[model samples]
Target: MSIRHGLLALLERGPRYGYQLRTEFESRTGSTWPLNVGQVYTTVARLERDGLVVPAGEDEAGHALYAITEDGRDELRRWFTTPVDRASPPRDELAIKLAMAVGTPDVDVRAVIQAQRAHTIQAMQDYTRLKAQALEAAAARPGVFDPDDVAWQLVLDQMIFQAEAEARWLDHCETRLVRLAPQAVADRREGADNPPSDGDGTAEQADGAPQRSPARVGGLRGALRRPRR
Candidate 1:
């Protein structure tokens, strides 16, 4: 999330103090990304320094207000028009953890995947319940347009969809692991049959003929690259 752009967007509405901006931002985003007062003030100061915002007259309560400049409007417009870059995605902690767990000795990779699946499912259920409640509330008052409720429902929908995708991915991972199990066992046996070289980079057969050690198998990359059954 671009806090700078977010603040500029709110300022585009009208002049607002740091506190007011913080409150409104949370309201618009359904508190998905809460802002601290200090963070709001800091971002506002940066915006002022960058010529994106300028100080407006103080509010009646003596709160220093800021208004977006033309430059800020231009920036906000560009942000709205530009597609968010996903060529290099943010690192996902669960993905990293699972990758590591797959390679680590004594780690239960299936258990890790199962735990994450359960958590994701639970979150999806919670979001679904929240969506149901929001719809019910909206139904109670027909023809009413609540921007806050709409914003919150959008956020909830995104979360639920992400959770659903994650659950499916986990299931795929588990199936892949199961399919690779036989290959993994075969690789282990092959490795046992062709032990490492004895100091000379060569192993001796029963006939005393030297043989090159077979390359190790069952690596994570190899498993991933194998064609799906």
Candidate 2:
């Protein structure tokens, strides 16, 4: 989420002070991406420097206020219209950790996947609870539509979806590892049982380095599947 563009979008509604901008942004996004007052002011300064925003006036409390400029409006419009670049998706730390864990000397790859799956499931449950609360509160309110309640519900829904996806992906990783592991073990046994031969099946590598069959040169999949003692 681009905080800069988000601030500009809020400003388009009207002139607002830095704190107000921060509050409104969080309220709309359910505080998923928090912005400190200092960060808000810093981004506001940059926007002013870029001619995307301008000082409007001071509020009754003497707080400095800003309003979006024509350029800022244009930028916000472009942001809304432009699709977020997914060609190079943001780095997922869990994905990186699991990728590095595969075949890692002493790391329990299955344990890592299971732990993450559990954590994601917990988060999904939390989000579900929050959604239920939001829905109940809205229902009690009758005809009055609360914007904040709706915003929070949407944020909870997004979090639930992401958590569900992560859980599914973890399951997929585990299944793949299980299926590939036995084949890799079989390959190793085949290679080890039948040493490389020189046509007559009586020759060695000659250099004393154990030889692996041509078909099993790079079978590291079994390494991820820890062998039972």
Candidate 3:
């Protein structure tokens, strides 16, 4: 989620001070995307710099109120209509760490993955417990319970679904690692990093360096699975 676009969209509705915008945003998104006062002020400064928003007024402390410009409106629309790309949705530090683990020597990638899996499973259990509490509280309140709060419940449900899927993926990765362990052991007896020159394989390269074609997941599903010369 682009914080700038979210702020811009909020301003498009009308001029708002930093605190009001932050409170309104949390309420509207059901507390999913919590914004700090500093982050909100920083985003406003960026919008002002970009000329996408201008000062409306100020608080008693002289903090500027922000109002959206035509450019801001255009950007807000673009953000809403254009879906976030899964390939590069956002920069996730955890994902980066996992990718780097793939190339690191003396690191047991399986242990790393398993440790993460265990943590995620614990998180999923916590989420489930919280969801149950919410439901129980709602049931007790009955009439006072605003059904709109179900939005948070839905978010919790999606979190659980993703956690389950991740657990399954971990199982898949572990099985693959176990199956390849014997081959890996043999490779270690030789020079582990060296290629098997006599095998049914050759590295494809662009320019003079080995490169991967855009064949996702081994690229063997739709195309013929053959070694490059």
- In model 1, state the lDDT of residue 65: 88
TM-score of 2: 0.80
Q: For all candidates, what are the clash counts? A: 0, 0, 0
Give per-residue CA lDDT, model 2, range 183-228, as digits (tens).
Answer: 9789879999986765534344556556776435634344334365
Clashing pairs in 2: none
Write down the TM-score of every candidate. Answer: 0.82, 0.80, 0.70
Error of 2 at 102 (Å): 0.7
Tens digits of per-residue lDDT for model 1 on 88-170? 45789999999899889999899999999999999999989988998899899999998878888898899989999999999
Q: Which one is best on TM-score?
A: 1
lDDT of candidate 3 over 7-114, digit per residue (tens): 887898898899888987776566777999998898889989999999998878786688999998988888889877554345656567767876788888889889
Model 1 regions lying over 4 Å from their true place: 195-229
> Per-residue lDDT for 208 in model 1?
62
Total clashes, candidate 2?
0
Clashing pairs in 1: none
Worst 10 residues of 2 by lDDT: 217-226
Computed on alpha carbons, the lDDT of every model, listed in order, comes to 0.87, 0.88, 0.78
